[model samples]
Target: MQIADRIEQALDRAVALAQGPGAPPLLASALRYAVFPAGHRIRPQLCLAVAGACGDADPESADAAAAAIELLHCASLVHDDLPCFDDSALRRGKASVHAEYGAPLAVLTGDALIVHAFATLRPVAARDPSRMATLLGIVTEAVGSPGGIVAGQAWECEVAVPLADYQRAKTGALFVAATRAGAAAAGVDAEPWRMLGDKLGEAYQVADDLRDVLCDSDELGKPIGQDAVRLRPNAAAQLGVGGAKARLEDLVRAAVESIPDCPGAADLRMLIKAQTALFFPKQLAREAA
Candidate 1:
């Protein structure tokens, strides 16, 4: 099966399990709403890609890891769009979880997804306890406090924060987890893949910064100029449009170069380049040109 299909199947199965008998009806619906019609699915795709590049000895484990990453990502989005954060009403061209399901349900949905992410890995543990432990540690560190996505979000509340630190925590953490967990899922050394994830994650955040500034709500399916409105640190605002675009290009190149030698390295490089090309907004491309 294709990578995309695999991801969808895993996610669908997860959501189905969550919706089993005795489940709360509205909360279940909210969970589906938060996850379905995925936005990019970049993190999960990267996880599976790195797993494939590493030979994917355990395809089932890789699928679980990918689905877990995506679930956490979806959870983050649900929380990020709440009134306390970006207050975004639209996501992926549809009403956001909080907007469609109300704040209480949205909060529950995000929390449930977070728990479900860990639960998704349970079967892996039964099969290979050691591999499951490694994957759990990777995923946990990416979303937990001190250096994870949670820290990234907490930084927004602090009096002062470094841009790079914030970006790495808020965005890069999961990407790092994705790449590292991918290798672990395949029973390979995961450390070597961290650089690729770091570069790609930062690049993705920079691209997001550019999109927030240059793209309309209709184009991005989310609020625009939020960085300026919220005074959040933004690469585009820190670096000029041209400079941010240049930075993104540099990161993409670095990410591709960072791919370790493996059977699928060449193909992975091509895929990375192709995927990142879509990151540039048409207007940004025109301006850069």
Candidate 2:
């Protein structure tokens, strides 16, 4: 199956599993709304791609990992668009979960998706306990505690912070999980893939920063100028558009070079190149002109 189809299937299965006889109808609908029509699917694609590059011995486990990562990502988005956070009405060009279903249901939906993410790994654990344990550790670390994405969100509520720390925690943590867990899912040492995820995550955030400034809500499928409105730390704000573009290019280069020597290295490099085009389409257009 195509990677996109695999991701959607895994996600669909997860939501199906979440729906029990006693589960509320509204919550189930909200969960579906939050996760469907995915935007980019970058984290899951990164997970699947890294797994393939590492010679995935068990495609099932990798699929679960990819789906779980994406579930967590969707959970983040649902919460991120809440009134307490970005207050975004549109997501993926549709009303955000909260906007469509109200704040209480959105919260429940995000919470349910997060629970379902860990649940998605249970079958994998029965098959390969060690690999499943490692995946869990990697994912929990990315989503929880002192330096995870949750901490990334917490940073926004703080008084003062370094931009790098904030950016890495908010955006890079899950990416680190995606690449590292991909390797771990393949029963390999995950350490080597960390840098690639880190650099790629940073590049993606920079690109998002640029898009927030340069693109309209229609182009982004969400609110524009959010960083400025929210006073969020943004690369474009700190370094200006040209400098942020330069930073994004440098980070993508670093990400590609950081790929370890494997038989699939060429394919992995091409994958990164393709994703870089997604990250900096405007820059590519400018250069072509």
Candidate 3:
């Protein structure tokens, strides 16, 4: 099956598992709403791609890892759009979880998705108990304290924060986790893939920064100028449009170059090039050209 199909199916099963009898209907609906109609599914796609590049000896485990990564990402988005954060009304061109389901349900939905992300991996332990520790560790670190997405979010609350540190934790953590987790799921050495994730994740954040400044809400499906409004770190604001675009291009090149030597390296490189190319908004691309 295609990567997107695999991700959706795994996610559907994970959501279904959470929606058993006696579950709160609103929370269940919120869970479904938060995950469905995924935006790009890029993180999961990267996970699966890295797994494929690494031989994908355990496709089932990789799928679960991918699903878990995506669930965490979705959960982050749910929380990120809450009133306390970006207060975004729309996500993926529709009402955000908090907007559509209300903050209480939205909070529950994000929490539930985080739990379900770990739950989705339970079957993997049954299939190959040996892989559980590594998988759990990788996923946990990506979303947990000191250096995970949670830390990334926490940075926003701090009195002072470094831009690179904030960006890495907030955005790059999961990408690093995705790449590392893919290799771990495939029973390969995951360390070598970290650089690729780091570069790509930073590139993605820079792209988002540029988009925030250049694109309107209608184009991005979320609030624009949020960086300025919230005084959040933004590469576009820090580096000018031209400088940020150059930085983005450099990161993309670095990411492609960082791919570990594996069977699918060439294809992976092509995929990175193509996907990162889309990071440039049409207007930015035109101006750059």
Q: Give the 10-residue window scoring lowest on summed lDDT in candidate 3.
A: 280-289
Model 1: per-residue lDDT, tens digit, 1-289? 9999999999999988888899999998999999998678999999999999999999999999999999999999999899998888988999999999899999999999999999999999889999999999999999989889989989989878789999999999999999999999999999999999999999999999999988898998887899898888999999999899999999999999999998899999999999999889889777656
Give candidate 1's whole-model lDDT: 0.93
Compared with the true structure, all predictions reach lDDT values of 0.93, 0.89, 0.93
Better of 2 and 3 by TM-score: 3
lDDT of 2 by residue, 1-289 (tens): 8889988899899988888678899997888888887779999899989988989888899999999999998998998999999989999999999999999999899999888999999989789998988999999999987878889889988878678998898999889999998898888899999999899989989989989888888878899998888888999999988788889889989999999877688999998898788887464457745
> Candidate 3 on 137-236: residue-level lDDT in tens?
9999999899899999999998887899999999999999999999999999989999999999999999999999999989998888988988888999
Off by over 4 Å in 2: 281-284
* Global fold similarity of model 1 (TM-score): 0.98
The estimated TM-scores of all candidates read: 0.98, 0.97, 0.98
RMSD to native, candidate 1: 1.0
Question: What is candidate 2's TM-score against the reference?
Answer: 0.97
